[model samples]
Target: MSESYAGKINRKLLKKRRIINAAAGREPADLVLKNATYVNVFSNELCHADIAVAEGLIVGMGSYSGMREVDMSGKIVLPGFLDAHIHLESALVSPREFVKAVLPHGTTTVVTDPHEIANVMGTDGIEYMLQATEGLPVDVQFMLPSCVPATPLDESGAVLDYRAIDSFYDHPRVLGLAEMMNFVGIIAGDDQPVEKIVAAQAHHKKIDGHAPDLVGNDLNAYVAAGVYSDHECHDLADAIAKLERGQFIMIRDGTAARNLEALVPLLCAKYADRCMFCTDDKHPSDLLEKGHIDYIIKKAIALGADPIVAVKVACHNAARYFLLNNRGAIAPGYLADFVVIDNFQDFTIEQVYKRGDLLVDHGVVRDFPAPEVEPYLAERARNTFHVETLTAEHFSEHRPRGIIGMVNGEITTVDAGYSDRIDVEYDVLKIAVVERHKNTRHIGIGFLQGYGLKSGAVATSVSHDSHNIIVVGTNEADMAAAANRVVELGGGIVVWDGGAPKAEVPLSIAGIMSDEPLITVNEKLEAAKDAAYALGVNPGIDPFMTLSFMALPVIPTLRITTRGVFDVTQQTYV
Candidate 1:
């Protein structure tokens, strides 16, 4: 049923012979780019040559002839961009649709974590994403979710221990364990997280970190436990500390948590090699309207970073860190994946090639077949929301703890201690977290300040880590109505006003992603934002995205869970 070792060696030898023949110009290359000026990653400079492609591998870069040729006289070719870290599920579309949005932006490869879906569907969600991304023109690699339920304080649909994900390490696309969000657990030598770190090390897989502001001996303990990278640094000192301690810093510039501007100093020559670019949670609107990694590269160049250094951070550094040896360069023996840009200053992508095949031409991605998902997985993903019907009384809170204050432009909240006043005029609102998994009917009620909601309610099943239904509103009735609407839609974001849903976007797949085109998802999201704005939500913060992070118990200060308003630092209910 399989070839023998000798047979495999002979087959490889024969292929190598053919590649050598093409390189020596004894035989014609399958395709060649004539008069090309490509970035030489090895030399850290631009050079002129004729690139030869055969069998999807770059065989040579000197004078070469091919059966088919394209004259690329004036264009500049840089290695195709690679996203160091991202959660593809955060795009709120299927992998196929996400690829369509980013391919034209010159993102030929992405390393994604399916933790959002994993928190909902468990291993089934991971399997669905793997199957969905297989065989696409853009390469999709994975880092298994290191913390499924995130922590013991919150309730999630499923819990994945290391034993549960050990088998996934064998998959070719699976790089390593994803962001280990349980930094506290790992530092304390907790059995659960320690075992995971040991297992990843056993397989020689990379372990990523998520310690927001860890310092001193605690940071040392976390790094000593084998977590090699982090994307959560929000300042220069924090990033530099981690970099000096041998952790690769990922400069994140996503829709919700943007740290690129603060971490740009790491893009300089002193620390550039140890840094990479990532968009941890890019919403559909941002992806479609602005751009993907290309947008990051352009922004970096505009922010006083050298074009070559920025490009290297976007491509080569990430590839080397992730151990993807075949790509991230435009040299011999690498995969023929690169982007043709007009120039370094503007960095406007003109064309994109993956394995020598033009996938995006003139900013338009060619149509491709959507990946087939297993019938059972699709059926399972659609039925993720399991909650009972709720009435206005379910959201009623007679006694309230301290207000969970919303920080402008940040997910971190502050403890604006006990406000007994129900003052809607001072921008105070009622916020509730309903347990949607297991139909527990558990609800946590609290008051929120700085939301700026004058009337109506906004609810979403996209709550972070746990994904419980979180709603913020002026009245209990409207909050109940919004939560009920989210459940009725199977799973989605909803804005309810006047006893009805004003705008909604259904995410049927694991209550986090849609199978529809990204354009449709983006349009729906924009409409939802408009509806929230009309209800008097703050103009500065993202209404839905800000609400989604309220349930996550890992972040510092105060957060809401199915239990109640919690103090993350003290590890207890307020």
Candidate 2:
């Protein structure tokens, strides 16, 4: 804005002042790009213009008079990329860590889902993240996590009701509700103590959706329910269907990188209207090696999407769809959020500007403060231990609780299945939940299968939903020793066998992610994953990812949360 986020221009007064001062003969242009072709996503028109930026806003954009200008001469200028869907804290610990990872790719702003941490620590976690990202190289706006546990089916750490959602509405950095993952409950007509959709509607905030593989009548009903956007489409047809229903389809490529290739076709002129790009959930390894939203733009163009179409998916459409009038374009009064490309192919970044200041030059964060955020949830690592039994009877004590199945890479999962109700003769399965909090001796036990290793035990504090310690074993002694080690080391995911732990990754921060640098952590985690492969665990499409979602009652087919088990088809706890 000429006056910094000013709503309306005092145009008549300014026009009079322009006559009196003559703007001091245009002054000296603070920065100028000479003879660059502007990729106007709004008009789909290519124009050669000399751009002048002053006071951080594009004060003049036209054929230039002789002015001080950087020699752009032949480079292209498109609006900087935007990540319409992503979770930054989930991707890495701090904003600088993430900006270091993706800024060179031309992504200058991100719409994040912080509901993951909010699920564990409630409002406190949300504020910590917000304070940490106050003045970053990129604009960091949050969509208040719609569901803290994500759904009422589980015992999530905290519940964010309508009032809680409303309380954050005017918070300077807040956008709207994060992806509303509970489509099954919404469609099944379940009215509990509170409805997330009701909160979004009352506050007039956008409610992002997460409905994977929803088809036929259910998909149509979900659209009508007033959830406006989704990033969970795995196929092109799914993207097209949701776009047809007026839901902005966020083509996502997170750690798993689904839908980047499958749905690039939707950026077709027929449907480019509602297309956008998102990272959804990326581990730091992926963020470091593979680019963020810029990687998607290149992939889409490589897959034959027009360069303009790809840029629109990454920038224009997200802004237009959500009515984020302040950005998504390089016009007057919009945020000074744009990128100056050094070159296009292989995409070398030159400089980045956010809120009208040069913050990143040649991919390095410039003049920014590193946030001093302490690991506040340090005690939760000790609380991770809970259940105290080792025998098969301990797991089966409560009528065979739900077992999680995972299919690596795919985000959704198969429903929770029943453990065979045997006469206690055969060694079938056992599962455990290691509390990553300060309960080292506590372990939650249950029975499960599908990893196909009942003769041995597979243990991990990476249990989904509550992030507690979960181990599945045939022998009580093996399960006990494996679960005990996680508590001993504070918190981590581990696997074990008869006498010793096979592999482990200590995650001291709320049991979900590590405060340790991701590269160090992912290397160890991958080593453990490789070990699971040697033990006959099928990776790349195994029961791990599916098991995490098994507890998520939001996605269809079936899911299980920290609760006993959710019958998503019945929209009730089984």
How would you encode candidate 2's per-residue C-alpha lDDT over 468-514 as one tens digit per residue?
55665656667667666766655566677657777777765555566
Q: Per-residue alpha-carbon lDDT of model 1 for 1-574, expressed as tens digits?
A: 8999999999999889888899889999988999999988788789999999988889999999998898889899988899988999899999999999899999999999999888888899899999999999889999999998988977888899999999999999999999999998999999989998899899999998899899999999999999999999999999999999999999999887788888887888799999999999888989978899989988988898988888889999999999999899998899999799989887788899999898888988889998889899979989988888888889777885668999988788999887654578988788888988788888988888988888899999999987889998898889888989998888899999997889999988888888789999989999999999998998878898988998998887899888889998888888
The 10 consecutive residues of candidate 2 with the worst lDDT sum are: 16-25
Off by over 4 Å in 1: 1-14, 419-422
- RMSD (Cα, Å) for all candidates, in order, is 1.6, 5.2
Q: What is each predicted model's overall lDDT from 0 to 1?
A: 0.90, 0.65
Candidate 2 TM-score, true structure as reference: 0.82
TM-score of each: 0.97, 0.82
